[model samples]
Target: MLNTALFMQQIREHPIVATISIAAGTILASEVIWKAVKFFHSQLSGKRPLRVHEVLSFNELGDICAAQHLRKSMPGSPELTKSPEPIVLQCRNMYCSLRNVGKIVEQIDRAVYSLDVAIYTFSSLILADAFKRALQRGVSVRIISDREMVFSSGSQINVLACLGVPVRMPITSKMMHNKYCVIDGVERVEEIRRLKQRKWIRPYCSVVVSGSVNWTRQGFGGNWENCILSEDKELARMFQADFTRMWKAFEKSENNLKQE
Candidate 1:
């Protein structure tokens, strides 16, 4: 009532503070209105408001269904009566630590046909041994990595290469920063056809592992990272296609080097 113009001038001078204050007021008003609506609805319906635990459980179920729908709706997705369960790992909660690394190793160990990996960094010895064991089991394993990172100290790329794993790196100076692995199932085209003919569903499917976490100790233990292991055949097919394209590109680069 005393100095409206002065107050307005001050607000104009500090636009950010004014904006924050307005936003806070809006949020507070919205919360008040929402609570009022809920209260009135509860009174009319004679139903109590949901407890925190009940709300959380409902949200958890929703999340599971959402995850399933996301993978199921993709093109060429497998026909399934139930949702496919995926393993999620987060370093912030210790879900992506060394203990959980066994989960990835377990998938690798189970690979019967092929294993394809594309990663920015490769230095995890545990992962390296898992690949070795897969190779010993007669599984075809191929790796694609960043060209520069391969020469980095403590990198297991060269070691795996020496051990007979087919490794490819782009010749470009720019980093090839992708972290994914595709684990192919044992079912071949003929096997799938045979099962279809016999009216038997295929039990095994390819798996795709991807996320922000690199194949390194720091990525698994130190950094805030997340990884997802999905048993979606279509998703695995997509990753496998990308890996194939890169593998061919790297091979072309090698040919050019030979001519040069």
Candidate 2:
């Protein structure tokens, strides 16, 4: 086996190549095994693997034209034009939709005063465009996202920042795993200070949207996720307080870093 001896000699001379070849072979073998098992299981069960088109699709979320339209403005309907009814009659409305992009877009569209978002991951361009529309309408929008994810491939945090949205990230090494938004709620400590000097009254009903959903393509369409939209003033107030604290903390950390 002179050929095999020569191959081993080359591998010994180039250890990195040998390592890469082994890794590639292991991965390919695992993939082959996985596919074979699935194929056999499907055949035994008399079921066929789902075709891509047969799966639920969210083409609108990915459509550049749709995103452009959303950036301009979502079309208004009588129901949308009317004042938003409380999302929940009692306290909270739990929504688990196979298609939740519209639900989130509707909430963003309905924001009148302020929107505060804290999410671990955000990559959906349509949702980012929705935020831009809200900003254009004079709604104050702020976001706090995970620092690591901010630099992740396809993250839109920088795009939002470039469009003049205030974005912050935690200074701690821990992940900012929050996934929530406070709508029409107090966003800043300065707002709270101003409230103390004047008769404080919320002009619009405050709402808090929080759940397992990340603002991503899979999160809205493919994942088994739940979202809760609540109109409870107490819940909204608490969420706002947390957001304000985190916003201030992030700001302070930034200032400290600049000084350093």
Candidate lDDT values, in order: 0.68, 0.69
Candidate 2's TM-score reads: 0.57
Q: Which pairs clash inside model 1?
A: none
TM-scores for every predicted model? 0.56, 0.57
* Candidate 2 per-residue lDDT over residues 178-239, each given as its tens digit: 99989887444347437566555445556778888788877775566667766665677899
Positional deviation of residue 120's Cα in model 2 after best superposition, in angstroms: 0.6
Best by lDDT: 2
Question: Which prediction has the highest TM-score against the true structure?
Answer: 2
Instruction: Please provide, for model 1 over 206-239, each residue's C-alpha lDDT reduced to its tens digit, 9 standing for 90 to 100.
Output: 7778888888877766666767777655566688
Worst 10 residues of 1 by lDDT: 51-60
Alpha-carbon lDDT of model 1: 0.68
Q: List the residue pairs that clash in candidate 2.
A: none
| Residue 95 lDDT in candidate 2 | 30
lDDT of 2: 0.69
Q: List, in order, the clash count of every candidate structure.
A: 0, 0
